[model samples]
Target: MATTALGEYLSARRAQVTPELIGLPTHGVRRVPGLRREEVAMAAGVSVDYYIRLEQGRERNPSAQVLDALSQVLRLDDDAHLHLFRLAGLLPVPVRPAAPEQVDPQLLRLLEMWPDNPAIVLGRAFDILAGNAPAYALFDGFQQGPNLMAKIFLDPDARSFYPDWDEVARYTVAGFRLQQGRSPDDPRIRQVIEELSQASPDFVALWDKHEARGTRMTSKRFHHPEVGELTLQINAFDVRSAPGQELVVYHAEPDTPSATALARLRATATVESPQADQDPGQPASSRSSWSGSPR
Candidate 1:
């Protein structure tokens, strides 16, 4: 998906709403299903030619007033409105080298001691900052390198690991889009976006949707090579005082086959520190032998 501006987003949204929804009269023999460009221009108090130019990417910049008008005319919600403003360059620029939040020592201790729990700590940009032994063993294949986003987007094994590959891909791209919107100026994020855009067309399509999401609760179904299939209840908790840092932990439902698999994995567990496994600067809680990189 191509990076879009406010004009393009507004125009696309307008084209999706029906005439009746917006109280517009459809004249006889209408060619387009939704409101026409002329109708949107009239509603937005702009010229049809200008609206066309905006939609075609000929005009990239838009003022706050115009964005407000367009937002009102398009009936966009607060999040959508903010997205439009950011894309238009009407909002204040995002801070550079975003301030890292402090991680709670308690949270850190929990992750360190949970030897059998497949838990991982992630940074705002989806960096696998840390994980316990089980997490390392479960996702070791994707952590061979330091980058998690790159592994999922570039590796083929990811499809086999995730039983619902399509849903996983969509969620991953959506997460990336949310990050891109929040930190548009981050050089690392830009490079990741460019790489994924080139690597996966599916990612490109989902990225274009401008979906915004943060690390939160989600259930995942994994087809582990060793464990077969495991359905887990995943909970993501923000580490208090740690801005942009989240702890994502996976738990198997009680008395189920997945629970049994979890128990078996625990029985075969081996403890390894992130520093011992990898190099300096990476957290040990996230290290695993599958890919052999420092957490």
Candidate 2:
């Protein structure tokens, strides 16, 4: 019904926040998704009409105290909190476009050095800007392009790859939303959203929900086709030298089955392993810079 960005976010977030999450009871005949408008209004210490207006795009520029209260009620993480401020035009600093999408030569070399670890560098749009052999093996074959958002939503195998598919999808969309804060008119963001919306209903629903998720270190479980179930902690880092680029590394606990699987994957990897360092077109294998040859 022609929603403003703020309104769409508030509405979707409200839907995802369960009554029990914020200590509300399961009342009978509940029809609406997530916490009710009245419940949110009461919890945020605002009038019901005001809350509705905020969700409907009739109200914007909420005071810091009000925004903080709403964030608490919705259980938003730190990244989501900043995104909310940015959406309301509350952030003090002027927003700038993400730095030019470039992966330093040294950084690519560093990724190759981590033979045992599955590491990848992600561009702003979640494209696999570069990755090591293990990281490439982890993703393996996916019909959807290298962009993670596309693979998660469009690929047929993602459901089995990620045990908790719904949760992962939500977080991915939220991360994209957080990126949106940095560049409002980024064509890449718009392109991904439009294509995914038409291709996957799940993406459409999650995107409408407006969960602003900042990239953070977290644990994730994957059912690897080759290695069975593996629990790995995702270490996400912002490249200080190149803003908007993330160096993500995967770690499995020592002495665990997952660790053994990782070792096996490393052992199998050879000097002739597939190159995951760049997009499909330009393979790094034939290039002159071949010092770290996937060993």
Q: Highest lDDT among the candidates is held by which one?
A: 2
Among the numbered candidates, top TM-score falls to 2
What 10-residue stretch in candidate 1 is worst by lDDT? Answer: 286-295
Clashing pairs in 1: 1-204, 101-243, 130-286, 131-285, 131-286, 274-284
What range of 10 consecutive residues in model 2 has the weakest lDDT sum?
286-295
lDDT per residue as tens, model 2, 81-104: 888888888885334453335577
Per-model lDDT: 0.67, 0.76
Q: Work out the TM-score per prediction.
A: 0.73, 0.80
Scored by lDDT, model 2 comes in at 0.76
Candidate 2 pairs with clashing backbones = 12-209
Identify the runs in model 1 with alpha carbons over 4 angstroms from their true place. Answer: 1-4, 11-36, 39-81, 89-93, 98-107, 215-217, 239-242, 275-295
lDDT of 2 at 221: 84
